[model samples]
Target: MLKLVMMNDALRNGDAHLKNFGLVYDDVMRPRLSPVYDVLTTQVWFPQEVPALAMQKTDPRGTEKWLDQLELERLASLSHCHNVDIVQMQAQCREIALQSMATTLDECPKCPPRKALEHALKIIEGALPVPSSSAKT
Candidate 1:
């Protein structure tokens, strides 16, 4: 669930805030994050600005909405209420989001030259864990 939300946020450049994500209970009352929806490419509009939600308890940096590696780690920790293997989480979420992002952009008329969309995907893909070396202090 955390991975999916972070992935959607990556694909949408940090627009996938708490309100943009939710869960649905099963007949047995088990909860699961709802399918990714309302993932708008706000990047084209707001560029890299404030995230829709804060990643840390009182993270002022998150207000910048850059979706950098530090924020990814913070989100990962929060996703399951503890730290999980960010590498595995990213791989899983990327697989789920890539198809949708590609399909959506592939259909866009403005996404000409093909490479343009590809370039965009690469940027979103870079929204991965901020390695310890580069992560903010």
Candidate 2:
């Protein structure tokens, strides 16, 4: 759940809401988070899109609202993770997003132009909360 929230913020996917998440059953009938799906860069189209059903509220009259360090901290606390964990997760999500989006932009034929997607990726990257390299667990 933590990773999903972080990834949604990192990828600037404004369509991630409770309904988008589901539980998948294991062989023992234990349920776990289903693989993330329906992810769309709604901000690329709407530009003013805020996170869907995020914990924090966005100002109606304001521009796009993004999760920041404080929100990350709050999420971490709720998930029982340390600050260092959030930092590492954020870095991992950013790296994964960059690589995956690169492949997507290169291979997707029906998708928008590479340049436009690249611009959108830049916006997503810009919104990530920068973690300190020197921070330790």
Candidate 3:
């Protein structure tokens, strides 16, 4: 879930709030995570704006900081979170980020330049708690 929120921000420059995410329940009375929605290119409007719900560990909740290894491990230790394999998550997040950008381009013909998308990729890659070339300098 942390990865998804960060991906929405890092990959698409979105501003996901609590309202934008939720759980879905099936007819059989089981609950499952819902697909991420309400995503938008918020950076296009508020270029310097931060996400409504910032990812955090030991850090302050509202501050959007680039997560490092120990921080990610803390999250992965949670009962219902991604695995602790940071490397694997990093690669997977990159793949998802690229796919998301391509999908955006396909759906929104007026999408911004490729370089801008690439820049977002770095953010997404960096959110995996590892050193990535795309991380903000």
Clashes of each: 0, 0, 0
Ranking by lDDT: 2, 3, 1
How do the predictions measure up, each by TM-score?
0.58, 0.76, 0.61
What does the lDDT read for residue 120 in candidate 3? 54
The lDDT values for all models are 0.61, 0.76, 0.61
lDDT of 2 by residue, 1-137 (tens): 88888888887888888999998888557789898899866777777778876574344554446776667777678778765567778888887887887788778857757666877778767767556783687
lDDT of 1 by residue, 2-115 (tens): 666556566665566678777788855778777767764455555564466655634654344545555667766655557576655665666555676688676875756565
Worst 10 residues of 2 by lDDT: 56-65
The lDDT, on a scale of 0 to 1, for candidate 2 is 0.76
Root-mean-square deviation (CA) per prediction: 6.0, 4.4, 5.5
In terms of TM-score, how similar is model 1 to the real structure? 0.58
- C-alpha lDDT of residue 16 in model 1: 63
Where model 1 places Cα greater than 4 Å from the true spot, the runs are 57-62, 67-71, 79-83, 92-119, 129-137
lDDT of 3 by residue, 9-69 (tens): 4454546778877899785587777987877556655556565665565765546644556
Instruction: Write the number of the candidate with greater TM-score, choosing between 1 and 2.
Output: 2
